[model samples]
Target: MLKGLVIVCANGCFSSMTEANSKVKALLAGRKARQCCELLVLESALGKGGAPWDFQRGSDFSNVDPFAFIVLA
Candidate 1:
């Protein structure tokens, strides 16, 4: 089966990580994008220690597009 992947950006300059997370969900639900199994956040959003937010919730999101993640940088 073909899985999907999405590159979500969160510079934290204009948008917050939470907003970026919302955007990622939007992209997954977007019609143009493919079936995303993973959602990678930019380095700026995820700090070195990965403090701030827990993107782990996305793992069980809908489960319609396979698995997902917010890879720690």
Candidate 2:
């Protein structure tokens, strides 16, 4: 299932992480050299204005990093 999804995304049905990362890297590289860093926002398919995941709350989140948020709206 994961392989199928990745293949679809790679075929342009959706944007994959590799594409997003490259785009972000290029954008940041062009910014002012003096700046330490900058932020680049990308829409997520899982939690960005979408249904919640199977394990999105309470103890389920305990096994996951706080920064690794699902895109549930």
Which candidate gets the maximum lDDT versus the true structure?
1
Error of 1 at 46 (Å): 12
* Stretches > 4 Å off in candidate 2: 1-14, 31-35, 38-73
Task: For model 2, give the RMSD to the true fold.
Answer: 11.9
Top TM-score: which candidate number?
1
Cα-based TM-score, every candidate = 0.34, 0.30
RMSD of each: 11.8, 11.9
Where model 1 places Cα greater than 4 Å from the true spot, the runs are 1-10, 30-35, 45-73
Error of 1 at 17 (Å): 0.7
Clash count, one per candidate: 4, 3
lDDT of 2 by residue, 13-62 (tens): 23555565565566457435316544443333333333344555535755
